[model samples]
Target: MKSRDFTKTGPVAMVAHACVLVVVVCLLGAAVSHAATDEADSPLTVYVAVGVLDVDEISSADQRFTINYFAQFRWVDSRLAHDGPGTIRRDITDITAPRFLILNQQKVWSSLLNVVDITPEGEAVFRQRLWGDFSQPLRLHDFPFDKHTFELPMVSFGGLEQQVIMAPDPQRSSLIADNLSVADWRILGYQTEVREIPLTNDVSVQGFVFSFEAERIFTHYVVKYIIPLFLIVMMSWVVFWIDPTEAGSQLSVAVTATLTLIAYHIALAGKLPDIPYLTRMDLFLFCSTLLVFVALVEVVLTSRLARSDRVELARQYDFYSRMVFPAAYLAAAAWALL
Candidate 1:
């Protein structure tokens, strides 16, 4: 048996052998390790874990309200957790919280800045406690019987929608404390949602919006403004019962009612915020004022008729005015309130 030496092999054969060796070595290198290091990896996206909100309290006075809002935020950097931080957590301790707002005041929201915690898995926890006055463009057109939906959004300041996303908690959408104190405004339940709002710079960002629906307790408004106005209008109606033969007495009552109604309307107007359009209350007041003025005119006309020696005609006209005036007032009220 003769053994062949590789050195004695032909040049072409040796070249082919070397090529096979090179291929095997390259494949092994790829299988064993990657060229890039762990530190070289950068995070492109941050996913916020589902969170819970604990609302402390809510109180409102017509336009704006005070809220003690608290929430917890969990942010995960999965890529960083797997590589940069193996078993231990990363901490970026700072005094500032991550957000800006469109609906709340900067001064008040600044105080809402909270603490952060980063776990071993690159999970950042943000604990927030905020107390501030939030304003809504109240559609008080249906005031006292109005239902309102108000939004409180915690918006991301610099994070773009592509870079960061907010995930609403499946377990908890909104958690409101029982016995929330709002005297005139009834505190109904709320809903939580994840939203993307457009920024001035043409980019959009993610946020958590908590919407609260509330109903105004009608009894208070009825007691404060509506009943008083009704009483005054009734006082004016007293002229209808007065003798048409006494012109001095009739004029005195009419003048007194007119002045009193004008004063009531002015005072009530002062209580409301300056709105450009008419409200349900405004329409009612208008109808009431018109009725009172018409009543005063009726007194004037009837007294004139009596002085002209048509006493029976004056009495009949006065009787019709009372019925027609009240009926029209009632109809106008239905149109406005209903």
Candidate 2:
């Protein structure tokens, strides 16, 4: 039976099928676009307020004061965006960015500025946000979020420059700053200002402002630890004055000088971040210790020669000790200054 041939009606059926497919595609496209628009227009608003207060005395002898500042972040709007897998909402469950907050904390040298502390008070500010999530373990190269302590030098005036990442998650929010760069969702800008917050007790605030950038922190290290340590090492090389024949006295002086340098290294290491490579301070300390050790070795060698048959050699050694050591040390100091 030429059954009512469906093949003869193929063109009409094909046209109807195509029309239905098009309508479904159009509806799906509209839904996705509407959802995207809603998310894009939604505003994720966070409010941050800061209060500065005194913490405690850093040191009695130095007349140094430690101050603490509290920062509070409140999540004002969670409906600003829709959450999806691998989205910003998922990434920043704690609302705090992985980057550091730059603060003004240096009080010693005018040209040096950096962060001083990242307290629980500050972390609490970030924790209050519903999006806060910092469950990942911090790697070595990861930015540190803790109290940054600084021993101010004798000087009193300094300024701090801090650059904080307002929004680092690209899929989340926009940042507002004139000199800022935005990529993906990271914002980079600098905050440069002179801060002078007076303590309640009239003690000078020994700490500078805090910030997220590393350059500001390392600048202080260069000026306070590296420069001063270099000078001290050069000064220690002056021990070459005692005669090699007075080997016992020379050894005593050298050992004492070396011990002093070791003490300095210990103090410096306690303050500075632990790193494997030689810092500027480390270089200076090592050089100073080596010079003292060399002087001790020379004294021992010259004394042994004098006990044997080389008294003249011992005398010559004393001559070099007077001239060569002083000259070399002076030259090194000059080079370092340059």
Candidate 3:
């Protein structure tokens, strides 16, 4: 066969050129499409702020709280640009914005005003008021004397941390000075922070955190729980001063104090969650109960001594107990509270 000319002029060569042209065009188109996709998937930065309008209720037993608050979001999207001297209202769907859900939300009430404000330059602002119950772990180890930094974290929906990042907008973030409505805590301070929260071992999402520190307004606990506890503990001490010779009266006092402390412990159990770890109050109560029990044992021993005609020795035991019991209480209180 004559050496076939494979130059472009030949029919076979022309067909081959055409196929090469199509392949090159497909590669170029694919590259352009990939660039577009990359641009679309680039990270979006949203400035976020949260303001607490009121802290309605905090339930220690349930580890949940009800709060009223408003959140504001700001972002810029060129797709939303329009000619306007001032901000104009637009439907929320018209704007490209990050959507998020409170990670700990138990129940929620929405304001239902699904609208966003847009400026001529496409700066968008979205605000919403929310009322809800949110759950959080409360560290009650200190109990009535405990201070807590309550956290509310919002994580973007359907986006990874790299896709939607949150930055705190300090100018718009604040806690209300009044109307906190929480009776047992004094607000220390509040702040907003950007955090990354893991959803799985390999996945995490950006989060906006609004947190406030509050200290227990422990005066209520002191007056309502501690003072009564002190009185009950003091009542147990009465037997130490009682004449050991009157074994009957001494037994009566000790037995009554023991029973009352037991009843009080049962009543107080309803006030807080039955956590496995002991709280400061629990420790103090335990020490008080132990002291009462010791007094009960002493009463029996002294009564036996008095009956056995060791009356002088029984008085000596009473004398020592009167001094020892109060000292023991003070030491126990310091260890538990401080």
Candidate 4:
């Protein structure tokens, strides 16, 4: 009877041990599956928001002028599925699809808009939210205000390979294709206007200002290329002061200067956007060219006078060119600035 009891207990113990092993294996399998799904669903992303105010037409009576602009974002459903092992791998692709909302506020002029008001308005335009995949970590910060903002994300991609798309305005008639990638992004360095348009009449005039902090490259171009070019052409008029016997040499110099200006224009053509209206750069080039042509004409007239022995008249030509050319150039610049 005792042997029968022992034999029954052994079978019962074995069965219990087998059941525990089965439960452990099932739990391990479920944990692995959950981790795999999480990995497949994670990805990184970037977003941008923009705002503009038109203040071109304002009356003196309207003292409370201001425009407020901001942006928010929503997740758009994407067809692409995220399937990757690393957190960076999964999130990097999502950076291509950015989403955001924009808010614009306009008010009558309360007082003259100062530089501080303008600075904040510009800063609000570039705030963005960035997120990482798998880890689901999020980062929120102000977008790089410098020209190099476009190139900052390239560090993650091994080499610079990023694209930029401009947000559109529903209310405006003009459609601007601001979309650009790495190759075209570099051209922004050549852009002169940080904020191209002010508040206009069709839209209520707002006192708010949006301006770009000029980059080093842009500053360098203005000081080194644009300013120096203008100065050189203006100085060419001094050639009129040289002896009329040297008039032929002066003419050659004027012609060569004009040609050099043309070459500069051609070199910059690819850097600028194709637009119907003239840019500030174009205006500068045009004025410089005109001055050079005027110098050429003055030289021709002086040469004729010298041949007739009217040396005094030839010298008078130099005096007028020195005074007239510079004054005219200053007037044109003032008008353009206004």
Candidate 5:
């Protein structure tokens, strides 16, 4: 029964197999062609411009700051083939694969106002003015003496590292140092670099890094924190000169100075978190606090000696401390500076 229909079935089966092979071959060829086209496509270059508008706030404790800036992105799409008598300018919605910069750290970017413009040579521009609260890494070990390179990176929305690249428009926001709004920092200049940040072992994205070089102005810290703390240290020294026979007055002065040092430290530390490591300011506060505590301890020891009728030894101890304490404090301060 099966042999009787072999003649009709043989040609039909061969034709069906032929069609399947042709379809598979066509699909494989199309895939190879698509990959080759992607490899041949030139990388889109995006030029970025940034303008420093204002600084809203800076928090060392949080390692973040909020600033207002104007940003622009310009690029050319050689792939789009359109023939017009002149340039056809349109909003960004008409463009595909809008490459924009995003903050590398946690940020809040809102209230952005943007404009789009296109040129006859396939050049497209997207400019935005926005305020962003951006996280930055802090090197507080140097505190007021620290220098920072604040980096902002721009990346494409849908392009890979091989598909897009970024460069700074030196003619535009390169002079951001001239118009920066923060007084506590002196702008050193700006620089841009191309970077491929790894998202995974097999995937990395291309990005443009914008660095604003700057250093903190230490005048405010010295005037507000250091000098006052130094005065308090000197104030504690006054207790050392008090008569050892008068235990009440010496103890009162020493205790009062120690309390004042504690108060100053508490107030100063209120602005920053109690980090596990010591900063330059912390080192200064530590020196001052130690001086005051040692002075108070000396008062107790000398007062006790005087009570034990060792008046000569107590006077000698006080005289030596007069020379030793200031020298030691000065030495510590110099060491810190060096």
Candidate 6:
């Protein structure tokens, strides 16, 4: 086609110029609208704090504990701002806030209605109280001397990763040492953490954790289990000191001590969870039982020697056992502890 440029400044040129201006204005508006939408879609940062009010019960058999606690959330949203300059209260249902659930909660006994405090500047504080059982995995390889770190994990429910995020509120998170009434446990310390945890193959959520460290008191086991076990095992050793010629009486005493130890084991079974692996305490108990059985075996041997008319030899065996039994037991006990 030939170029037809007559330098024409007419109605057609003006109309073409107007259409171009409209197209440029429309493109600029779409860009501005897209930027605003992105700003609105960004996740809101919520500060999370957990305050443990009381520790009601800890069940080793069930691997769970009952707790009364309150969780606090604070965030700023300009949409919630009001005309009043002071703070005002509102029901949580009426306001927009993040919802969460305890990831390991087993049962809930009760929960108080949630409340939110809103400031004129759009800062909001939300508090909710819960009483329930939370599951905790326990490792008892040390048993009476074992220390544990218990955790309660909270994750955002029904919210996407681009919708919410969590931050630790150190100023508000706390553990009430005096209110922790778990029997035979001493509270060491506590802390809070903010993290992101994967929920599924293609999804993840914001997580908050409130954790506390505790150690078993151990005095109860020392008095009620270990000391008594030591005495029962010591009773079995008495057979070695008795006159070997009196085999009947020696057998009776040894049998009685063995029966008592068996009963003790039955009583302890009720207090601990049925686990597959052995613990330090279990090792000590096994050694004690073995020593008692060995003592019983010695009594039989000495009695056989006396019956064979070798009374002097029987007495010599008894003398050696008196020293050897105690030394062996002490070594085994040390090994279990170390």
TM-score of each: 0.75, 0.40, 0.83, 0.40, 0.80, 0.84
Candidate that would win on lDDT: 3
Q: Which stretches of candidate 4 lie over 4 Å from their true place?
A: 1-217
Task: In candidate 1, list every pair of residues with a backbone clash.
Answer: none
- Shift in Å, residue 287, candidate 4: 0.9
On TM-score, who's better, 1 or 3?
A: 3
* Candidate 2 similarity to native, TM-score: 0.40
| Candidate 3 ranges with C-alpha deviation above 4 Å | 1-35, 82-96, 159-162, 170-173, 200-202
TM-score of candidate 6 on Cα atoms, chains taken together: 0.84
Q: How many clashes in each candidate?
A: 0, 27, 0, 20, 0, 0
Backbone clashes counted, model 3: 0
- The lDDT for every candidate, in the order shown, is 0.66, 0.43, 0.84, 0.44, 0.74, 0.83
The count of backbone overlaps in candidate 4 is 20
Across 212-232, the per-residue lDDT of candidate 1 in tens digits comes to 787878897788888887787
Q: For residues 1-338, could you state the per-residue lDDT of candidate 4 as single tens digits? A: 44455445787787887898998998898888877555345542322223322212211112111222232211222323233232121232233433222122233222222111112111111232221111111111111112321111111122113222232233322211233221212223221111222225554211112222112134545665677777678667767768876777878777777788778778666544454556555666677778788888888888888889998888898888888988888776654422
lDDT (C-alpha) at residue 253 in model 4: 73
Ranking by TM-score: 6, 3, 5, 1, 2, 4
For model 6, what is the error of residue 90's alpha carbon versus the real structure, in angstroms, after optimal superposition? Answer: 5.5
Better of 3 and 5 by lDDT: 3
Q: What tens-digit string does per-residue lDDT give for candidate 2 at 135-177?
A: 1111222111112233211112221122221222223322223
Residue 138's lDDT in candidate 2: 14
Q: Please identify which of the two predictions, 4 or 6, would achieve the higher TM-score against the true structure.
A: 6
- Residue 236, candidate 6: alpha-carbon lDDT: 85
Model 5 ranges off by over 4 Å: 1-40, 79-94, 105-115, 159-162, 170-173, 177-179, 198-204
Output the lDDT of residue 66, model 5.
Answer: 69
lDDT string, candidate 6, 1-338, tens digits? 97867466688887998899999999999999887677468878788888888888877778887889888888887768999868998887676666778888988864766778999998989877888899988998888788888888887655333477778875675555475778878888888887766668998767888898878888999899888888988888888789999999889988888888888888888777999998878898899889988888888999999999998999999899989998998899888866
What is the model-wide C-alpha lDDT for candidate 2? Answer: 0.43
Rate residue 86 of model 4 by lDDT: 24
